[model samples]
Target: MPRARGSGASAAAGGGGAGAGHGGGGRLSGAGPGGQKSARGTALPACLSVSAGCRSSARACREGGGRGLGRAVLPWPPLVASVGAGGGGGTRGWADTESVGKKRCVCLLTGAWLNGVMGRRLGKNKGALNELFSKAAGMLACIIRESAALTRDVLEQHFNDLKGTLKKLLDERLMSLLQEVDAIEQESIKPLDECQKLIEHGVSTADDLLREGESAVHGDVGQQNEKLCIFTKKALHIQLDSLPEVPSLVDVPCLSAQLDDCLLTILKNQIFRHGTVASRPPVQLEEFVEKPGGILVRWCKVDEDFIPQDYRLQYRKGTATHFEDVYIGSETEFVVLHIDPNVDYQFRVCARRDGRQEWSPWSIPQIGSTTLVPHEWTTGLEGYSLSSRRNIALRNDAQSCGVLYSKAPTYFCGQTLTFRIETVGQPDRRDSLGVCVEQQNGCDSLQRDKAVCISTNGAVFVNGKEMTNQLPAVTSGSTVTFDMEVVHLGTSSNEGGNFKLRVTISSNNREVVFDWVLDQCCGSLYFGCSFSYPGWKVLVF
Candidate 1:
């Protein structure tokens, strides 16, 4: 738009003179056009012909610059000439156009689509990974919790099993101890042969002494009576004939009374015999009577033959005090203290009543202990009552006198004999109630061998039979009472062997029913002997 400042041609030709100029055109420094004294070294052109818009000229400049000088006049110079035709000779560079704009549009579109697709895929993968990881975490937690619970259960089961094992071991140890104790007791009671040897030694030297003593006693009595003129003493001697016989004494009204008589005899005999001679004198330790109400012990008389005058009596334990006296008698009797409800006591009493001149021995130690009173006494009955008997009324009705259960009534062919015993009163259901069967094998009493019992709780199989076993439990209902018997399996017996069965149902000692049935199997279909329960009538009430 304006004239170019500091033209290169103008600057190059103005060597020494000022050219045609305005007032301040000549060298202002007053030196020359090329003055080194000017404030600025040179003035630069106001505008540059940068390659912003002129593409053809820029191409020509770039191409011509790569060639040799004078080769093809550059379009740059031609473009300058065209501008100079309008009084301006300069070139300008080209500016960016449509191609770059189209490139930018494509780049923006491709980058946006790629970023969206990749982001979605990455998001989906992350979500799936998180789900799987969460599930695994939950499963791991459940496993850990279950493992803890299982460990707890295992510990509890282990403790219970250990406890059971310990209990079983303890029970076995206790049974072994009991067996050892029984063996020791048996050994203690066995008689020693040494006692016989001791007796033989003493007896060998006593014949002459015993004979002289008997002779002197008879002469003294006969001579003394003549001097005193006490011929009436013969009646005193003969008065002994009036003494009650031994059997009569045993038949005394009560056991307590008989015991008292024996005690009196021991005391009286000790005074008389020990006063006469001392062959190992008798000395009593202590004796007394129980006061108030009690199951007191009393002295009882014994047979003269069984009495040992050298035996002395002593009492141990209880409120009884001490004393010294010889208890001499033909027989020995000593009493125990009385019994009371809920009381348990153990006491000892001894006698040297057998006058082998050795002090009499102590009696068997006895205990007065009562069981737990589970039921209250109703009416006058202090105990329950039970009894079982064959209905004689049925017998009178012209039925069979007795029916045989089998050849071996208590046999072992897996058979059962069920029978009932009737009882009186409502028995104590809470207490242990039942029946027992005892088998006696040739005894003066029916108390020898008792077989198994079928009790209220259930079946007991006792056998000399081949199949020996215990059975299950039995039950009872409320009735005054009834006989419930289950006899299973038969017993084995040799031909002609005697085996008696005694069945006893007891409610304490006061109320009881006892019966016996005798059976013999002699290879016959019919059992040889079958008897009704004995004493059934007395118990049935």
Candidate 2:
């Protein structure tokens, strides 16, 4: 199905599944307190798209209509014995229930009610009949006690029957889905168990051999006669692989705070202690240039408590993505490394400490961007307001621009892209603000000449020259607002640097995008900034 792009406010409000592609678009639900009913099965004011042959049920979607909204009154479970009795065809299609006989019965009932309410009669004495029905002997009993009972009986029976039929249909559907899932589980898991057993056997055998002392292989004459050979250094030297470079600690990304202390201890012992057994280090980090072709990714997790370094770290069956499938000795934290850097990649880290078989939830997936330049994306702009009545006079003037980071280390080429900003708050005189877009080449804000900016004054300028577009006016008491569109069209003179959008007052405009000074850093109007996807493919030659 086609999907709509999400708004900036939606992403920052991350408590719900408000992503652009999943779940509802963050709209408020119409349910009342404790989910009380406001109308027939549905709360009033709820948005529902009606399908064909759903008129009776559809009436509940609206309010203030005459005739009570007909709710889908379902029957008791175990009431519907068979689908065949509930009309062989599917539920309530136009052809199944709209026969000539049914139509006549409905019309007759409708006419009777209209005639009685309008004070009309079947023949010439309309007035007399109306007076008789209104005030004659037992007039109220005729309508309520007698007529209402029959109508209610018929409706109740039909509703009960339909309810039973729907329940049966859903039960059948669920059973089918469960069977399919069961088959899939059997097919995928049976072989995995067999493979795991074989791996365990091999490890056991290797451990036994390594445990045997040299005495098991050696037949010495006597302890005193035993000779130890020592030789001088040989002319020919052996060449071996060089050690892998240590990765930066910051490269690990944000991890669970609970695991921080435990992870530090593991890294200290493995890297700092230089402990090894059998002439091989307990932990080895090796790097090699992959043959410019297919590549592999690996993940490792450890238990929390102190674990012996000799613990085996080998891949196991059924674990498709993790390398060295062995759980790192009881360390509650995990560290991930990009064994191969040429390919685009992502990795997940999960850990469980102290013999806890249930693994902790996997950390958020982290993607490694291939760009040489480093940049950061913002959370997008949100909840902003215009301070003064003058600023509310225009679209560009009343709006807020969000922050976008370059994934690459630098933006070498200039390009134009739209930045979506969101905001809501009270406005005041001191709450000054403006949009700042410029290239950051290290400490200096480079390319001051080719930047673009918009401010409360409703003016847009690039390279110190005024642009054609002007800001729109704002309305009072408006909480949410967005920019129509703004672009950063790069020029030939300036290129390459980090870009940051600083919300500031007009007086402090210092970072000049295309030579237009954005002097202020107004924090009052500040909500936050929105980040772009990345720097790669953004800057074109």
Candidate 3:
């Protein structure tokens, strides 16, 4: 044995320096002697204790501390005094023995249980963390790429519509401007043409006057007088007009576009900066409602000014650090399905606008859980046996249908029971699966009078009455799922009013839905199923 370097006299000076030595859990700092240090700077010796109420096994444990008992073995301490024996003369501690001690027959110590537990737990935690991280990363990548692409497409479509409208508007304005130019041309030309007509008439009148004057000056005495008299009469008949006043032709109508010179440039700059991805998310998580087998996560836009084109929801398990995108769409409320019962989940929402590259910041996370209980097979009879909580097996000896029941009643609305047909001895119409209001401890015929079930064929039986709803036919490998909820309970406790039960069964690409109304109210319902054939295996979740 390697003795402790610190002496026992210092430990005996009353500082809780006892029981400290070389072992798996006994090593302490250089505290004069071995022991657990106290808050007041004093050390106290502590013997090994068991939380599961072990009496004799407590003090005898040397190597093992509180962790080992079932896997136990005890080795005798060597014939040396404890390292902290008072001046090597105090009461003997568990570590020291006067001679080679015998193994305590009452208790055994198979040590290192805590180390094993830590090894397993840490290893599993790391693997789970990696898996969740990888899934979250992949989900985020898909949301980013797909959301951005869809938003881009929608934005382009809207822009295309805007461009069409703009083109039509510009065309209308252009036509109007051209028509104004035509009007100006017509108006100005009419006046100029009238002035030209006046000028022509005046020139003709002046010519007639000159002709009379010339005839009168012919220089002949008798003939000149007579000709001048005729010319004078004709000239007097021609009324003279003053010179016409004409407008300058340089004054002409011109047309120009009304918009800015850099119309395209203005549109480019404005449109480029018109839309924005939200900097801070306007949507805030409202509440989480507990449903039968799911949670309804709801959100709302806090800032009415910031209108988002879409919203995306994300969630994570309570113990998880990373959250994965669960939904992305315009609906503000989404029901997350297939969650384990009673397990806590955290959820958040983000927003994105049209033509935006990124989603808005996530809303503050909210925690939620479902109200349904965990499902397990509680009763199996005759040829029916349970392999696990979710699996059921039917043996070859089963003459009639083997039956199984859930561990407890599931009456919560929206809770669904899903079963898969893994194997079948043979396919027949006799095979049925459904839920009932009663549970039997032994194999018995299905109480069809109070239950609803579906067969391998397309027939459905409701309360002992067969109804052909034309549901899809099932074969060896079909999946069946069913759920029931109370629509309206009886109004009076005396069972005098109407009670409604809404039951839905889905399988083989079709669903059979029916509602039963009676005079009595049913507070709860139990789920079970019976199979007539042998070698058929079913698993439920």
Candidate 4:
């Protein structure tokens, strides 16, 4: 028996070699007399066989002679088979074996070539792949970072907007609350403020009444004291009775709620309601005239049933806060004394009934002022007697024949001097009732050149010269009025302006007028009546 060759079994069998032909396996497997053949009727190729060992140089030579079946097994051309080979077993089998060996070598070379090419391509593309993946990762990281920043900014802006909105709402709410608080404060304090004002007014009025009573008592202890004491007591009693009652805390809410309405109602009641016999004040209190350092005030009651037992007069100087009182019993007119001259005064009056406790409201105020310069008598008139009270002037004797002048010169314009002659006894031509321009020296007389005089016998004289006209005749005990007016032709001055003396004399309803124009020497003048005999009586105003 032939020993089974390891790699050359099929080749040994196909070649019919003398040895066992299975020492080494060949590249292909072939059939033996008792060996199993492959299913395709072809020997297995050595390269495809799993049990085949690596080819050696000596076994290759042996297989190079046999015709193996590698050509049928593989798709490539048989590398070992020559075209010119004989069709004998030896040649054919050798060709088959060589072809199997060549096919195996080609497959190994192809595999190695594919592996080298793939390794070079993979080396070239390695950096590009790594760079693409790195850029994608960096882009993703950048996107994430930007997204986070945008989210943070959005959140911050949203928070800021929310904060501003909240602050504006809070500020508006705070302002509204402050305004409400102010309104509440004013409303709450209004009634208290009015009450405080009333208390202050009452205190001031009491102080004024006390001061007035003290002054009246101290000034005169007789009738003035008695009247002032009674008035003070009555006023105090009225104040006490009319005082507002203090409300308790329990009534605070109701009082505050109705404060204004209650006050208005009370005022209306006081003004319109007749609670007692005395209701309203004396109406139509008027200022009649200005006396010396005082004003005369008068009023009347229009109601027939209203009989006033006493009258209270209150006076105040211009814008003065306090008042001075003058209380009179059963009198409608009273003089507010000890006032300043040339100053304005306001006066109001109230009436008290005989048996009533309440006094009437004060009357409407009347305003008046004292004179700038009061009337007075002239001084040092020689040969004449002057009475300031009666406004009379009389000659000292029948033989008196001089000019009796006023102490102060009259205004050249806008002034009139009237003299009434009660008696012009013993009428003479030299007896005159007129005005004269006298010099400052005592020697200037009515007989001077700048004088105008009218005689009781209806004769007129100018500058000691007889005129052509005759005035109305004056008799004894017949009242005659002489009026003289001086007009300056230019600006008035004692030394420079021209003056005109207009004189009118009337007696028994008959009148006569005389006019004369004089020079600057007649500017400074005196008003008097010249008497040539005794028993001449005249009044000057």
Candidate 3 to truth, TM: 0.37
TM-score of structure candidate 1: 0.17
Highest TM-score against the true fold, candidate: 3
How far off is residue 374 in model 3, in Å?
2.3
Per-residue lDDT for 1-541 in model 3, tens only? Answer: 0101111111111222122111111111111112333223332322221212222223433333332111110111101111111112112222231110111111111112112322233354545434433553454355457656867887798889988998999999889988987887898778878888888877877886787688678658878888888877876776674566765556754545566779889988998986655323476654343334555555666566777888899988876978998988888767665677667777778898766767876654545565454456665466676774444555455564455676777543344466667777655665567666667555443446666777666578777678867577665677777766667543563366777777777887677778966556666666666666667677655
Among all candidates shown, the one with the greatest lDDT: 3
Least accurate stretch of 10 residues (summed lDDT) in model 2? 73-82
Error of 1 at 73 (Å): 86
**What are the root-mean-square deviations of the candidates from the true structure over C-alphas?**
58.9, 31.6, 23.4, 68.0
lDDT of 1 by residue, 117-143 (tens): 222333545454344335534543554
Candidate 2 TM-score over all chains jointly? 0.17
lDDT of each: 0.26, 0.26, 0.52, 0.48
Model 4 per-residue lDDT tens digits across residues 51-146 = 122234224333434233221111111111111111233222222222211233211112222134212333554464344335534543554465
- List TM-scores for all candidates, in order: 0.17, 0.17, 0.37, 0.30
